[model samples]
Each structure stands twice: as C-alpha cells, then as structure tokens.
Target: MYAGAMKDKRSDSRLVLEKVSHSYGAVPVLNDLNLVVDPGEVVVLVGPSGCGKTTILNLLSGYIEPVSGTVRREGIIRTVYQQDGLFPWLTVSENIAIGLRSVEDPARREKELLDLIALIRLEGFEHHYPHQLSGGMRQRVELARVLAGDSDILLMDEPFSALDYQGRLRMRWELVRLLEKRPHTVVFVTHDIEEAAQLADRVLVLSNRPATISRELHIEALRPRDLTDPAVIGAMKEILKELGLQV
Candidate 1:
C-alpha cells in the first residue's frame, strides 16, 4: 500500500487487484480477477455462496494475499465485518474513542468522539455498554468507530446480513446518510441483490468458484435510491438474470 502523494505515485487507483488469483490448498477460488476502485466510489460485490466474495475482501484489506498477481492499495483502510466488534466492557463513547487513540490532543480526541457519536445518532447512549444496545444499535457503534478513524477506504463484508429484513433496509439508509456526511471509498460484499441495487455505484456479479466477474452493472441513480424506482428495479433484475436467479 502506498502512502501520501509524492513522486513515483503509480496511479489514482484507491484499491486495485490486477490479474489476481488465489486458491485454498488444492481448490481454486479466484482467477485472473482484475478490479480497480476509484476514490469515493461504492463498489458492491455479489456472487453465489462460497464464491470467494469474502476472500476478495480479505485480499483488499491485506488480511490475506493472492497466491498470484498483485494487490495495490493507497491510503489507510478499515474493515467492518458482519458482526459488531465492539468491546462489551467498553462504553459506547469509550469504544469509539479507541479509533481516536492516535490523536495526541485530549480535547480534540473527546470532541471527535462526541462527533462520531452524533454521526451515528447514538448521542444519548454514549455510556451504554454493547449488550445494553440492540443489535442494530451496536452495529451503528461499530460503524461509528470505523468512521472515527482517518481511513479513506472501507471494506465491508456483509455488514448488515445479521439484521432482520426491516433492520437491513433501515441500515442501508443510515449508511447512505453517513457516507454523504463523510465519504469513503467503499467495497461492500453482499448476497442481497436489493442491497446491492440500493448502495452500489457499480455492482459486480461473480461466477461460482474460481470466481470471476460475470457481469458489471452500473447503477446510474443517486444514493438513497428509491427501491421502487425503475432504474433500481431494473438493475436488480439485470443482476438476478446475470446470476441466473431470475424467477
């Protein structure tokens, strides 16, 4: 991963995978997969189960490296998993403060912590422990913690999959709102086509393992996309069709 802009900065690719391929022991997972995510764009990855969607995320986040090809990333990265990584012993405020531990100024740190609390709309629950909050609320704190950092890229792996149908829908809206306030280049993986339609600037459909891009759909609609809108529905249908799930 390259740091700040200087001489010999390769390109503007915020995150990139070039001719990337990986395998698990004897099993091939990804094959010559090439992707480039520009700054501030939300790219959603969708594929059948066990198609190495999360593996791609792990590659981008440097949790693992491709056995072949190159992975290049610029700027700091933070990941939000399906489950909230909140510390049960830490209060909401304290948990968020963990992200700001790098700040040397106490006053600034406290201010930023409170700002993140407000950003996640958990102002009143600042002192509450994780168990005291609902699952959705705990997830919000997880998001807030990530946002509190200076990371410019977010790798989210099925971040809302644990939520109920209604809860998932609500979190999508909340994510759009938060991103509008503090935009980050996001790579989200999900099995939900509707979620991809609602959140992605571009949706990538992957084929079954030895995963490769089957189709790439660009959603032209703006964020907070209307679910019933023709463009949104059309995109969803196109994705389903590409995945051979049109029924």
Candidate 2:
C-alpha cells in the first residue's frame, strides 16, 4: 500500500515549480529554482547541508509560500517525516485507522485498516503502542498511516534518517517493494547518496547556497538495485562529483 493499492484510478498527480525563489528575511535559499515532478515518478533531491532541500519540499507541500515564482500541484498529498508521527496514546491499529477516517463505509473502513496492518506485516501488534514497538516498526506504522489515505504524492523528508544503519537498509528495500506493487509520485529528500541511488528514478543534485539543480541524473537501473550495481555506483559517484566532493 505504498501508493498503488489505494491510488485514484484517475490519478494525475504532478508538481511544478516555476522560477521559484525564497529567503528567510535577507538570507536567500532557493534562487530562481524550477522543478517538475511528473505523475508516478520518484525524484530524489540531494545537496550540501543547508542548501534548502527541505525548503523545496515545504514549498511543494504548500506549507510555505515562495518569495517569488509559482508552485503548482495536482491530486492529494501526504508526507512522512524523519521522526514517526504516531500518537503515543494510540495503538498501532488505531494510529493507522486514523488515515482511513474518510472512508464512509464502516465495513470498507475496517477492511482497509486490517489490510494496511497486514501490508506492514504487523498483524499481531495491533494493540501495541508506539513505545512498545521498535523504531523500524514504528516507522512502518507511520508509513502505513500515510498510505491508508487516498494520496497521489508523497513528500518524504529524510524519513528513514532516525533509524540505525541496519534499519535504514531494511526500510530502503521495503520501500522499493511497496513501490513495485503500486507506484506513486514521490519527492524524497535525503543526504545519503546511497539512498538516493537506490531509490530514485531521477536524482536532482543541488548547489550550495541559493540552491539550484546542479545536475539531474536519470537512474536507468531497475529498482531494488544492488549497492554494488554499476548504475548505482555510477549515480553515487556522479552525485558526489556534483556536490563538489572528490569521488
């Protein structure tokens, strides 16, 4: 249920940023930036620290207005942050059920809830609270919650960053598996080049301050890519080079 199983049949979700520029007071961040995210595409943004990666996402999500330019989005949007946003008081099932509240039919709502719980492979942990689950499990639950809704675009801001190394690796593959089932338009921001290489259909590498697309690398390799694969390695190296790092 990453995005496919519950997607709109007429889903035509897209995001476009035209001549976008923004700043905090006098300090500028994105300068004349333009971006387009097509329907059912996964675009990853990578850049130096403080280069306004998250600002781009905020603008796309309409959480903030650009100082100049235009932002256009289509269809429903959902987000998953680095930290899981599950309510501490709610059980795993209840937390996921929150997303399905829009389903007017009681039987349909209950069915979706159970389907999502099984989709995350947490069938027996329905009654478990956030504190009772592991970090990875909690993140999975959070992902499930987002997916339970009718969303077309997923804005992810370092969603797996809080997990340990092993946990991060697992979630990476898990995400690919979910996407394989049903693709959705996703704009993901991460500092990890490996993560970018593994998950992106296209990677947009940004410049320093006043961020702009320094490079756009289309990953031709298939998903669930091996870290050692030539395309993954090549993309990672290219991203490092774009970021002014010696590869």
Put down candidate 1 lDDT per residue, 80-178, tens digits, no spaces.
Answer: 989868889999999999888778899999889889998998988998999999989988998888777566788999999999999999999999998
RMSD of 2: 2.0
What are the per-model numbers of colliding residue pairs?
0, 0
CA lDDT scores, all candidates in order: 0.89, 0.89
Tell me which residue pairs clash in candidate 1. none
Candidate 2 local Cα displacement, residue 96, angstroms: 0.9
**Model 2: number of clashes?**
0
What TM-score does prediction 1 earn? 0.94
lDDT of 2 by residue, 27-130 (tens): 99999999989887899999988999999999999999999999999977888888858899999999998888888898999998988888889999999999
CA shift at 238, candidate 2, in angstroms?
0.6
